[model samples]
Target chain A: MHPIGTVHYLVLSVALLLIGTFGVLTRRNIVVILMSIELILNAANINLIAFSRAVDNVNGQVFAIFVIAVAVAEAAVGLGILIALFRNKETVLADEVDLLKW
Target chain B: MSQFYTSTDHFVLLPAIMLAIFGCAVLLLDFLFPEPKQRKVLALLVLAGLFFSGIGLWRQYSFLTSQGISEITAFRGTLTVDSFALFFNGIFIAVAALVAIVSYRYLELEGEHRGEYYGLILLAQTGMYFLATGTDLVTLFVGLETMALSFYILVGFLRGDKRSNEAAIKYLLLGAFSSGFLIYGFSLLYGISGSTKLRDIGAAIVSRDLWDPLVFMGLTATTVGLLFKISAVPFHMWAPDAYEGAPTTVTAYLAVGSKAASLAFLMRMFLGPFWNMKEIWEPMLIVIAVASMTLGNLAAITQNNVKRLLAYSSVSHAGYMLLGLIAGNETGIKGMMVYILVYTFMTLGAFLVVVGLRRMDVIGDDVDDLSGLMYKSPGYAVLMLIFMLSLAGIPPTAGFIGKYFIFLSLIQTGHYVLAVIATLYVAVAIYYYFRIVRSMFIADLVDKAPLASSVGLRVGLYITGALTLAIGVYPEPFLRMAQVSFGR
Candidate 1:
């Protein structure tokens, strides 16, 4: 029955960021890695929306809209890339594409 | 009173909207005229549209100011028409136009489709235009991503090349990684400041607890996210690989477009939104600046591929631009502006020369590929020298003057130690740039070179080369323009 506040946004971001970090470190699937990025972006959106209310400024939501648009574009372009890469390499393991690593 | 005509009347947005329109037209044109010869013609038409828009915007600025037009508000405060955006827009569009011309032959030599590549180039330029004038963080973010999205596709343009695909993948992965960091920072800033509007955040910070450690941490984290995009030392690991792997044209785009957009955003984020907490960011910038230059320059010395070498060189140049940021004066900003003008020409010119040589099978970016470049193509060799010397900050080239002013601006702010380190790195940079020069002149030719002097490529090279020299010799006019544009 506890009401959420700024702290709730913080906690959500922390958890979201943690999940993203875990995905980045442990995942082999390229698509999942990209999905983790979405989680990270959503965490940002939560904070922005929370702050928009707290500060009483309209710019926050506007900025959030831009973030969503950018994220959608990113997801589209990124998945297209994954498709292209998969077509060529036949697998999605991050470790498999190690030929160019410095 | 009027609606349709004023729909695009937000003075700051004119160039950006024009660019987007141009992008759409380029796409449709490419679809209609998919043949190689037709594609070239369409590319020229798109370039003409971009050129007309660029000139129209530039001329409008002079006319408005001379007539003393007062407060012509178009978008109801979402934007403002100013000299700053106009100047940067010109630079972005001009660079894109030149890149499109060079890319015509670049794709053709690789036996790739010429149709949509130039369209994407125009689209990416549109993104940069938006990013520069973005008064709101929302606009800024949108502009940035539009630019980045276009690049993701362009980086992988060469379907036949493994290096191109790998580069695209790496660029996509790291790019997405940075976006996550950027959003996280944005959220953190919003959380503490209680606003996502950039100016609102500035206002909020003034009243709120400046000494609060949590708020400070949030802002710092946000900077880390943005700096990764700019490729400062720790965050710069992806640049070399991406530059080495992508096709040369995409690399040129990254070297110019990505870096320029990040710089414009950095200026806005710091000067517009976060200027209140100078103490927090000043030291952070100094550390990043010093680290970025030393690491980028020292790394460039060992690179074998010319593209990778320029990639590292660019990271070092980012350090110079950061130095201008740390100076945090009108002159510093002006210096950064002028430096961008010069850098766009020379850096892109360097890549163009590489594309030209690569087309001739003379050089595909191996340092040794340029062995006896002077013997086979004297004109290209000289053109390459112009670019290298400019990049090296040597005399009689735009690079030198640009560096001098940036360092001068910082020194005026009494950051003598930082200035000294920056100067020393400039010395180290000379060695690498001269290495390319030495290869062109000193190394013996390995094989009989195949060379063609296309009128378009030669004209493009001449224009950029002449600009580099002109900026070096008579920089006063450009400097004055930069000062006026940056409102000194």
Candidate 2:
């Protein structure tokens, strides 16, 4: 109900970013990490839409749409890749991949 | 000249639409012919369809100019049809052709699903073409996603390969996270400015210091997200695994076509909408550019896998391109365009050699695998050297010219310190690049694979090689053309 301010976005951004960070740093499952990324994107979308609504400009919303589209596409390819990788490594843990580590 | 705006069906926008057509048509063809081999036929058709249409678009260059087809377009002023877009599209088209030709050998021998593979690539190219020419944020996003999504699938196309799959997954998750940041930035700008059009945003910021800190933050976050896409240093963790895991041809597409598309959009964004904010983005970019270069080169120095080395190298190059954008001058922009063109050739050529080496279960990926390439296959060794030297910025190669233009531009802008660092790294780069060259030539051949290729692939390699050499030797034409091409 209140006109959105930067704080609202900061809170949402912090939460989403924290989630993504936690997932990336500690997640055992690759799929879970990916889902966390989606959460982060959704959080961004929320912030964008809130700001867009506050600013009354369509660009933010338009960009959000593209973000969604890209997210879907990225997810499709990512899962396909995951499926492929699991087929080979038989595990989804991030630590399992050391084929190219220095 | 005032022909149409509401039509949304302009021939000027044919490349964008044609991609969707090719993508869907492949699906339809697959329905009609379900056999695995039929996928190849469909892929060929998609490539051919895109090729003919792309050539058709190129032919209309004169007509487009004379008729003022640009001014007669819709979306008000959100998109442009200037020589810049056409020039970029031309590069993209040439790239698509190279990839398409390479794919014939790459996908077939590697036994990837032709329908999904070629269709996604065509679709991605279409997105890139749109993104390159997109005047507004909306079209740019749409185009970028179309390409990005396809790439996600592409990076993981060889689902059989664990590394490829892991790479794809990592890229997707990180890529999406970054997209969120990018969109949030766009929204903040929109909120502050009340416009999606580049000109509108620029005009709003130019007339007054009404722009706010939040907007700057949004922009920075967005840049961070996109930084990942181009595989810039901090955002570059995904590239090596993805590059190594994905099919070699897909790696080329990511390195060449995808990066080109993103950079084109970034050029417009920084030089156009964000131009007024140069004081803000410049120093920030310089920090990033330095980081990307130093990190990428240093990391590359430690890599034994050829694919991973190239991946890190590309991340560093993306940083280099950013230097041009950081300068925020016409020369800076032109340098970026020139470097990208050269980058496309050198990176793609290097990858083609990688693709050439990947035979049966043996992917010609590791540094050790390249040992004694001189005796095993002198031709590939020479090609790899062109790639390595070009990458190292050696003279008589496109990489050198690309780096030279950026250095020249940076020096012109009084970034002597950064230039000094970049040059030092250039020296550092020589060692790693030479490591590959030495391995290919000096070391003994541990494993030798037959250089098997039909005429088309061999011809493709020759054309790519010749272009790499020709552009490297005589870059004036490219520089002039790139300068005259876009909204600048």
Candidate 3:
């Protein structure tokens, strides 16, 4: 097999990005949707790290670290909001949370 | 690292640093006070923070002007202190201050008055400062997340309301999703240029072919992300619900402050790295501009909820602002600055009226709730009328000046078709805006209670209404300000 390279990483990351986008669009479960968002973020992180290596630069890797930190903060906030929502609605289905719709 | 920072960096960053300090101070002081009556002191402290921040911004502006330079790069060129940032920062401070003032009584009425609310406002303003000034992708991304996270919490500040919680979740999910798109694009940009600086990226992009797949993907992804933040058509599903569910005070802030900050970010990205790629993105933005206006105005006609109606109108306003960007001339850029400033005040004034209608027992968000407002509060009703007229871009209001400049820029650029289409939508907008006016004057009262007026709310209304009229009647000073700010 050919050695894994930048293009391989790009292809893999693109797959993850597509899967994440599809999940976000189609999923009815809010928790699952949040996970899909995480996947998309991870996809970016992979792209950043791979590109950093390809370019012989550290800025992309630094950005990836930031992305990971931000992802954690985002997940914390997302779960907190989810708990708040669940407490009120007694359900986690996206379709059921429709109070503000026109 | 020592060489990376200097006194100039601290001086340039003073406003944002002050915001952070004051934000923390407010949070700490809240625990100490813990009394509803004493919370007003927190509001005063918040205002003090904004006042100092404004002073810092002014100092920066005057210093730059005196030096005969338009911009100064701080933090090794990661942050740019320029007329553009100063102008947008002024808008952010004004929006935050107004929201803080009006929020006091509204929050108290809802029994959710807390120190964290004011603290979050300050912190969010701090984030906006970075968005206006940051020249690096890292700084911009961090700043965006800071502002957006604060908003997510603020939107759900009223935990007792199920709608608020639901709105927060929806916003958080969608917001994070969009950031994913943005980061992906940013990563591509980093790979293409091997640097995070916008200048370097611009240099790299200028040498590439127009049909380069990487550049096209980066542009498309970045455009989607920024458009989502601005709540343009097709990406605006979160705005109406979030606006309807959030506290009215927060809704106003979300509508004006957040949109302004995102527009700043958009302008930075487009005018910096993507300037040479205009040919590729201009057609795409034109389509979005038309779709946003058409869909925004048309959908607003049917919205019975005032908040949702304003949300859609804000979307259409986004469309109008995009026309300025699409024109991409000095006049077009100035038009955008003028429009953003005008929009901040008029939109805030309109929401202030809605905030006044809120009482302990009244939801006051439905269109029918505005019935007989003329009889209940003639002064407020008249103020609302001026705001409606301004929003519809009628002459003798600030909004008219904004629209005029935009249309003029479009015509100057030979986009007469766009200019005419925009004018046609003004007529459609007038119809819905007048719907509220008709309900206020011609319809009978559903309730005889006076509006829930407070000192802070009255102050906010007066400032916004007066500015709305002042800018409309004598726009010379404001025009000069916009001209100076766009000089760079």
Best by the TM-score measure: 3
- Model 3, span B1-488: residue lDDT tens: 26667888988999999999999999988987778767988988899999999999989988998999989899888999999999999999999998888888888899999999999999988899999999999999999999999999999998889989998999999999999999999988888899999999999999888789988888888889999999988898999999999999999999999999999999999989999999999999999999999999999999999999999999999999999999999999999999999999999999989999999899898899999999989999999999999999998999999999999999999999999999999999999999999999999987998888999999999999999999999999999989988854
Pairs of colliding residues, candidate 1: none
lDDT of 1 by residue, A1-102 (tens): 988887787788779888987887689888888898888888778777777787787766777787887888888988887777778878788778765543
All candidates: TM-score: 0.94, 0.91, 0.99
Give the DockQ (C-alpha) for candidate 2.
Answer: 0.55
Q: What's the i-RMS for candidate 1 in angstroms?
A: 1.8
Sorted on DockQ, highest at the top, how do the candidates line up? 3, 1, 2
lDDT of candidate 2 at residue B241, scale 0 to 100: 76
**lDDT of model 2 at residue B164?**
69
Whole-model lDDT per candidate = 0.79, 0.77, 0.93
Worst 10 residues of 2 chain B by lDDT: B1-10
Candidate 1 is graded, for docking, as medium
Candidate 2, A16: how far from true, in Å? Answer: 4.3
Q: In angstroms, give how far residue A67 of model 2 lies from its true place.
A: 4.6
What is the Cα-based lDDT of residue B362 in candidate 3?
Answer: 94
Best by DockQ: 3
lDDT of 1 by residue, B362-420 (tens): 43788888879899888889999999999999999999888988989888999999999
Model 2 docking grade: medium
TM-score, predicted candidate 3 vs. hidden true structure: 0.99
* Model 1 chain B worst lDDT run, 10 consecutive residues: B70-79
Query: Which of the two, 2 or 3, has more TM-score?
Result: 3
